[model samples]
Target: MSEAVLPMSATPVATSRAPTDWNGEAMRRRIALRYAAERRFRLLGLCAVLISAGFLAFLLISMGANGARGFMSTQIKLPVDFPRSPIMIDPAMLSTNPDQVLANANLPQVIESSAQAAFGKDGDDYISSGAVAALRKAIIADPGILTRKVTITVPASAGIDLAAKSDGSEADEAAVVKLEQARALSTGFNGGFLTSSDGTDPTVVGIWGALKGSLLTMAITLALSFPIGVFAALYLEEYAPRNRWTDIIEVSINNLAAVPSIIFGLLGLAIFLNMMHLPRSAPLVGGMTLALMTMPVIVIAGRNAIKAVPPSIRDAALGIGASPIQVVFHHVLPLALPGILTGTIIGMARALGETAPLLMIGMRAFVASPPGGITDPATVLPVQIFLWSDEVGKGFIEKTSAAIIVLLIFLLTMNSIAIYLRNKFEKKW
Candidate 1:
């Protein structure tokens, strides 16, 4: 029986020989493969970034090239006998009844007469159709100018403007050359494009009216949405019970964020316009509708930002006998402010660019004057661009591009401000 254990000795035991050969070559091969894959991934990421950047650069360059021409206009100097012009009224009448004088003064015929006397028949066509209105505006701005003989530089026709800028056909070029040789044609910066309002005449149109409306609309939107959104987020994150109703509300808010903007337009149409009887095309209505559209986005963003705060801070504040409200207001809110502002800025930018909802509420109308209050009829920059882009006139093309440039600049400014704020107060725990 003792001899049965002797069979185990026949099986030789094997131990490590140089620690299993270290497997260095296999490990090196695996490491090399991993590094190669990583390099390929990195290159792909760089290529994607470069492609996107290139597209953005192209868009900006195209806008600048086309829109730059809109900032300039062609002008021609004209010597006019103010008292002798057909549009001239008695100086006494101008002081006593300015509106009546302006209404009776046929400025178009007057400009036509001046052009004919200066350059002959059909020469008036080379002057902008808006020259009459321009002259009228000048006279209104300074009534005393009508008492003396004056030489005024007035806007040239759209055709001549194109020709002067070297963008027209050969026939147009010949006309421009003739005007230039006569010393009547000149080019100058278009100051009116920045200071005036929307008009059918492209040479006289400007974005100021739209810009002011945008400012007012955004003001209303911000005033309503910021506080509502922040508090709604606070309650949902800090105080709301985790119940079925809360869960439904949370889901509904998230879904609202993803809803198409046009749906909100319809809702606004039904509620704000059709039922509530708010003024159509007013900044008040537009802003309220946009506030509805934007509020959900802010609530979602704010909740996420609030959730990102570490629990330790809330606990620490509570341990010091701080009220729940006090903790939220003093400690948590300050820390979360940068993120909150980031969301708010993004929402405001979206509101600034929105057109569909505003259109539904009647902001698509041609608002020639800037709004004096939120309740006044108005059109925003985006709606203005939309209208201009659809015009049949060739002059409005450059104008549309210019409006787009303005909108882009505004968006850039907002995003820059957001970036500055985020970097200024961003915190880490």
Candidate 2:
């Protein structure tokens, strides 16, 4: 068996004429060349895909690198605790006069006293002199601080905060030295950035109030835009005839979507704020402006979504003796809900981030107090970021960037929802 070596039953002779054309050997070589070419094509496509992915990754990394730093903020934990012997803020001492308020007690002195009482001797160095101003602002904001000792969490000063979070490696020797003193002061967040209202001071400005305003604006957008848009879409797709007027309306809608957002802002101010004299910076006004801007988009999207639904569905509903309205509402609308919602969410989110119109209405101005309702003066996230980014402070840079990140996160989440709905509910008839 080891010695056995077998060949074909009939041994073939070697050919000198390059083997006959289209012989097995030649065919095999051609097939191999085709495979090699295909492999090259596939490899090129893969390289292009990888390059595209890399660019996308770079973009996201840039956003996260800048935005993630915002989350690492300066926070100040107060030594304040519940006091057994509370210095009753006699209601009589609640006066608006700065001198009378600071009369016998400077804001620093009062807060210092509170701190000593709370953390004892250990709390003396724990507080900063600037912390006194924060306390003053708090007291002025709420005169009731005279009644009870409360623990508050505030943001630390920018320099102090940056030092705590940074490893000192990123900063130059000079900047690092500048931050040394801030680091030496009792370590912790120097607060005001979290709970306070908008201000030029990066160390003092807060996002808490703006968060509420955006929520209200979105609420108004969803409440008003969805129903109106859907109805308009249904009418156009199902009931409206293809007439000259309808053609004009459709053209106008396309034009509206193309109109500059700022133009809408200007129109909003003219109609809602100046003419109607509604609250200037109210979420209601903002929502209305955005809704008007979004209506055409919704109508267009809604019409498309509705049109995409098979007419068979409508015919089937009508065959059962359903009225036109009933058939549409019950059968057609249900089928198009996913697309409708996707458009609505997209429009609402876009409206939420819009700032030019909000600025036209006066949301750029500072309000020491938060809004009480949708009609109250409000500032949204985009406008808030714009305000902060203009401030001439290193700290505000991170803060502005952080706000932008928050906005991006929100946008990404909304898009994800829309895509999810689209893919999940997509139908192939």
Candidate 3:
């Protein structure tokens, strides 16, 4: 149909709308936003790390500052007459009636006399009462110590010690200065704090008892926790079937790791104390309770470490005619040891610092003597720190800080050992 054909050039139909041009500005804006978001996230992470580090440093510094005073003791030099008639006796008499002679000996009078000669009016308040007891014990141990004209350095009272260290009140400052002018007051490293047992006197109180308890408790805890946890992990990871029960157990273990430590303490109270009738305030009970608390962490860590082992190791061992147990034990376990030990170290360190559980078991009791065995009554370092912190005396303030420092040192040592072991055992492959 020869209808009026429009000229091809004249019939200009609207072309399809042009595809949208790349919005360079929008692209730039989106990229810049992404980079900004990344930067903000990084800054937040760094700030968090820095804040944590700052708090830790502050805590350590504070503890160290106060603890330094505890390391030194104020002493007063006294010239004393050790009367040989009462104090210096035959060695045979010591073997036969030592207690009687010590009971009858006038050690207190000697100390009091010497102190009076030195401080004049304030003699009783100037020297530690515990120093008299210490002197009595020494003389009892060797009566010959009384034969000579003894010029001994005796521990000054806590107030005097504090004044000498510049932490005492204004009145104490005068006493300290007077003693200094008379050349009777001096500061020396306190060897007794490392050697002596816990005492009523802050000047004589030492962490040795608590340190021993911690060592014994950790030994028991490690003995119980490590093998049981490793075996449980081994079964769950290498042999246990994937099923509902296993899943429940896995979930329970993970949840247990997050449970409050005090709850475990209560559980220990119920089971170890109420049900079993075990001895209270013994390292045995403390260690058992801590083992319960630490096992979940070990299990979780162990499973993770075992899973990290290559499946090829298992397959290759099996292909070589090795049994499943042999494959896991020979090939997988050795590779996982480093991680397992790291987890163990972390658990032990946590156990060492735990006060609530130990307190629940009566470990907060005043243990005057170091524990000789796991079954003996004991108090750990954390408990000692807690007890000291609750004390009202100014002397205990420094003592509490000193105990905290000791705890930190032990923790650092444990972590260092963990690092060393991890590096020693870790394989490149």
Q: State each model's C-alpha RMSD to the native.
A: 4.8, 11.0, 6.1
Give per-candidate clash totals.
Answer: 0, 10, 0
TM-score quality measure for candidate 1: 0.90
Best by lDDT: 1
What's the lDDT of the predicted structure labeled candidate 1? Answer: 0.86
Off by over 4 Å in 2: 1-56, 74-105, 109-130, 133-155, 164-194, 412-429
Look at candidate 2 and tell me the lDDT of residue 303: 88
lDDT by residue for model 1 (1-429), tens:
564577776665455445644569987888899999999999999999999999999998989987888888999876666878886477678878877788788878878888877766757877897687678777888888777777667899888888888577676678788888889998888888887889888888999999889888988988899899999999999999999999999999999978888888889899988999988899998899899888988898899889988999999999999999999998888888888888898788899999998888899998888888999999999999999999988888888888899888888887898788777777542
Give TM per candidate.
0.90, 0.70, 0.89
lDDT of 2 by residue, 40-95 (tens): 99999999999999998987787687666765654555544324333233345666
Model 2: what TM-score? 0.70
Q: Lowest-scoring 10 consecutive residues by lDDT in candidate 3? A: 83-92
Q: Tens digit of lDDT per residue, candidate 3, span 74-141?
A: 99876676753234345566768877766666667778877776678777687886676667666666
Candidate 1 backbone collisions, by pair? none
Local distance difference test, each candidate: 0.86, 0.71, 0.85
Mark the regions of model 3 whose C-alpha exceeds 4 Å error after superposition.
Answer: 1-23, 84-100, 133-148, 427-429
Candidate numbers sorted by lDDT from highest down: 1, 3, 2
